[model samples]
Target: MVRAENLIVKAKCFIPIPPNPKNILSLKSTITSLMVDKGFEPENPTISGPTAGDAGVYYTFTACTTDPEGDNVRYQFDWGDGSVTTGWYASGTEVSLSHSWSSSGGYVVRVRARDVYGAWSGWSGLVVVIGEACPYVYAWNGSAYVLDNNVLVESEVSNGSDVEDFYKLEQAMAPYYAGDHFSVYSIMLGEFENEHSFIDMVRLYAVDHDSSVKIALTPDGQILTYSNPNPPVSAVDNYGYDWLSSLSEIDEIYYQGFPGDYLLLDFGSLDVSQAAKLVLRANLEWKKETCIHVQTLNETGEWEDAAILRTRNRWSTIIVDLADYLPNPEGTVKIRLYMTGVHKIDFVGLDTTVEQEYTITEATLFYAEHSESGKVTLKLLKSDDKYAELLPGEQIRLYFILPNKPADKNRSFIIQIEGHYYAIQ
Candidate 1:
């Protein structure tokens, strides 16, 4: 028992006990009176910066205090803007704190601190916060907002996966489509780069029946030329439908002259705002003895034979330059056909014809000065013929044949006749 009492005395010597509760109370009261005299509060309070608008700025405050018996101190802040914070500091020095607001508006921020004895100081002066405004962005898909420039523009997707689709330039110029029939508009934005501005939401519509028609937009939001295929089909046989199957079964040969059939192609009424080159292509499958001839009505109202193509057991394509045949063309452009040998015609495709316009200068036809004996070389010189001369800087078309062909068949051949020289240009 004596040894234990000794141990207790040694422990007391190592860790000293705090002052008596009554003594501590008296000291705290004295310190509180001193703080009151110094215009300091024992309870630390707070004030905050402004709460709203574009004046992006904010702030907090700090207070000072001390006790007769010095003790570690702390701080607390209440930004009247609905935010509160706390910190620790030395007994009687000034404490500073700050914050930034994201918009242009006023906010009140306040700060306060406390001592180790649960004594808080009164809040300091209020700090004001300000903010500034910024720009917004938007985007559109066929229907609802798919993406904004600020957001990711997702690919056309359905059933939890990306689906293939095509976009038409016509849709991009909506409401305006009625006035401008062939006017093209951009279908996608940021195709060139991911940078976009001034938009809210991008609308997108799902392509249900034909997924192939949805097109992707270029970086510049331009419509791409190679669009997905969703070709239209006809309900009847006369519309080139079933034409392919009809030519597949050919068992018997008709000895007598076969029935001749023809098709009339209508170009329809279209307003071409600018000069363009148009090419019309026709694909057909016929028998060995089948011969196809294409004729067009010129601006003079005269039907001219454009091309004559002969084919066997394969598919053949015929191309015609509409600019050469149709003039400020209005109404239906008819394609009259002549068929012999009981051959079947299948699959005819028509494209909107584009015409290419060019100028032809006058030229002269002259004979070559240097020539080998026995060799008759005739050169085409620049004559007064408006369609004959090769212009100095212009590219001209030329056609040539050996000395044994028919001149009548070679009537309209292209040739570039420069000064003292005749060559195919």
Candidate 2:
């Protein structure tokens, strides 16, 4: 129950001295919208600054307020960790301050304003979130994604729940078997400066598969190579229909043949436009220097001799270059096998070699991670695209293609993969 002008009251008394009245001391009190007046107070200060910032970095904040009585005002800041009071400033003035946090977390910043008359305003608060200075990384395990620091990574090809090793090479060369020739390897990131670090912009290098019948690698980088051997989609022979199923099979069972008879093999759609080399691969059992004439149909639909195969008394692999016989490089390739004498045909297929980029009719590359929920497909990381993150307790799976079972018992092939990742701090 106070009026505006009578919010507070005060009194003053002066006492005179005998000798020096002019030096008399006086007690004074009054209400001139001053400390004794409780009706006027400064407005609540408002805080303005960043709501989120990195730890260990200094950030700026501003506080401002207005006083009702036109009195000078000063600001008090509760930085959440400590309190700071600033010098006096004119009413409606904005005061700026800077602060930093040592660790990462959320903090509540508060500010208040007080006038020279000793009237204070209510406090204003703001929330700020401090983040770490670096980003986090995670890796894909055979089962699930996990932190990179939780498991030990190996350097070789691994099987089962164990983390697959990095920088391991595996090769397969079996010309005698159907669908069993390929080389594969894997890449992983095991060494890092910090547990929370990650990498990106990875690239792979390698040589072509046709440089030699064996696997070879350059010193500068590992090689990525694959072979595509397609079997005849359909087969026709004047002799019998029972042996047509055996034309594409690699087992010991063969197609019994008659002298001077011919068998035609039709391989479905093929892409030889980018082929480094095209060859007809076949397995035949011959006796006594007997020969088979590899032929192709010409524009006139007549059988033309392509190559002569000569082998004796054993099962031998025959490789004939078909480059000169291709009529349409991107269309289906058909061939005829004409025997000069009685022989057995075990298997026949067309093998294509690629030097650089080539389209895959079927998926030869596969990536899988282990988890209680079974295997999951992860995004393929590329140099110019977004990369993957691996956290602790996680592992990477091996990259694999088609399996290889060599016709020659001593044949071995190897595929290698290298991963390069740059950690962002």
Candidate 3:
């Protein structure tokens, strides 16, 4: 028999040469035949799924492929976020997979198939666009709605009750791209107040205007489109000797007092028609513990004590709520400070402590639309289930459960909600 080395050399020299020497097409066919004899790859995969979806929400996608040689096949997926499937699936099978994007953007999902011989086919890709989980938020920039990328609404705390120590939060909500209107589907509880805290009621309000507006809301739920914290239009004393003492807080030039001394202050025309609460503030001191009676002129032309101040020897500031005694058809409010025992007054003044500027009635659902002509029009809106359109320069307020007692100060919380914007043509 021939030597084994000679047989191996002869086998290596036997190449698959085409019968037609100058036929390029035949040569190509011969090469293709040799490749097929080794192994045939699977066909490229076809991907099918939703091309658009919300971020952080999962969606289903399907991929399918067939092998050219009818051999068993496997598939691998590229998720397009620098991630890929670690496992492979059977060939010629319609595989379904669910995936979610953590953020909003555009992504490309790709898949490829491989036969039993490990020959991978060309990759097939599908494009997907992910929208924000929350609605597109916009803020009224005094004229038009501008895109608000932050998608957060914030506010500062105010004293809820005039006498009791309680707090209320107020904020101006940004308008969302609802095309026309929107509805509150549900509220998703996130990092809000403490476990002990809860919302009592939710009040919704809206206003329509083509220009900017300066608006504020009081703790008692009154809307204010006018001036606030208005100081006494004029301050005067009974004696007229120390007229400016109550207006300015100066120690040396203060109004020295006797038992029956009184100071009168006049706060010019005020619109208390929609008044919720009014408060009076004064700066007083006493040589001995004394009493100062805060009196307001009622409609019957009689002076009544709205609040009483039991003073200590040192100078102290006092606030008296005067909600009940402030209705005057003439629109003028007069305050009198009657003293008992020895007392010294550094400053005496009157201010409107009504923090809320507007009120939205839950029953009738009234919204105040302010016109440039200093006119306010009451517009009726739908109930809590439905919300009115929020135009530019308008505002929206959310009411929560009032606290029973004062909690720790400087603490923080977050509020989250879920809703859908409608596109109405």
Candidate 4:
């Protein structure tokens, strides 16, 4: 009994042995030490990728860190650019983030991680967010027409006789006259008549040819009629007084004709006293079996040598520059048109039925250049004779007289020139 009581008292008195110092400080110090060991080699580091400059494009980065003792880890990411968010993911081995750079240049990202022991891993490598370059584009607006520089002289349509109806006359004569507008048409009689009767009537109509007359045929081919809407009745009937009266439905005839078809263009009236250029717009028609000759008429009414134009079908505009054709700088010049083949003709006015003739007195040589094949230059000796406004690629004829040859045949030494005028710098 004495020993049990005494033992308890002695145990209490003896181990006033100070209780072991609390381990709280040691535990805290341990955690702090582990955290200090968790620092990344490149503290607060980041890795980035390439992007386009000034354009909002994607940038990727990685956060790297390590713990001294292989421990369960968690990561926190800060793009460092300007976004703010913090979190821990279940599969938390590495921390990754994405961001876009607004401008062109290098940028830095920051990342940090912690271990389950409250040990913070240092930052990762400093990643550079690189920017890419961009390019520029230009734009414009308008319309333009282009023609090939190659020339085809006196060329015939490949299939002129096969599809003559659909072939265009202008296209067939393109080698001779390539212009913007042209005229073409056809004429038919109700019934075939004697050549004498037809030729007589045609000559009569030629007297006051200035007047426009309508010619038509009955569907049954029994009657032909002619009418002059703006008639001095005498002018219309003068040729065949009883010719029209014998026909049926004379009033229904319409005079829809082309100017180029029946009449020769008389450019002689054009005033070139102050013009720099003269442009003639004419319409022409062609048929597969016939040929049309274009010639100039002198004051004496004599026709010059003609330029034969042939076609299978279609209408085309024929342009003639009168600069070289005029006998004098200020006088009347005439153009003669003759049909030798089976082709027909017609004429139409621009904007109106009344034809207009423009006079040019002052002309400008828009362009004048030559190649080395022995240059033939036409210098402007008189500004008053200006007929030079012709565009590049226009056509012309150069009349040269060879020595010791008859004047008539010598003049035949005509050289056709294609339009390829160049402007002098």
Q: At residue 124, what lDDT does model 4 achieve?
A: 47
Give the lDDT of residue 18 in candidate 1: 81
Off by over 4 Å in 4: 1-262, 273-290, 298-301, 327-330, 344-425
Per-residue accuracy of model 4 over 206-240 as CA lDDT, tens digit each: 00111132211111111111222111111122122
Per-candidate TM-scores read 0.21, 0.30, 0.28, 0.21
lDDT of each: 0.32, 0.50, 0.44, 0.29
> Regarding lDDT, does 2 or 3 come out ahead?
2
| Candidate 2: stretches off by over 4 Å | 1-226, 240-244, 276-290, 328-332, 355-425
Cα misplacement distance, residue 69 of candidate 2 (Å): 99
At residue 276, candidate 1 shows an lDDT of 17
Tens-place lDDT per residue, model 1, 316-403, is 2223334345433344444444444333343332333222222222222112211112211232222222222221111111111112
Q: Which lDDT tens digits does candidate 3 get at residues 208-321?
A: 211222232232223333223444566665667546545464343566566787877666676554542333222233223346777787767777787665542233333444
Which residue window of length 10 is worst by lDDT in model 1? 410-419
RMSD of each: 32.9, 28.7, 23.8, 34.5
Evaluated at residue 183, the lDDT of candidate 2 is 44
lDDT of 2 by residue, 189-254 (tens): 332222322233222222223334323222222232335556777778866464557756667577
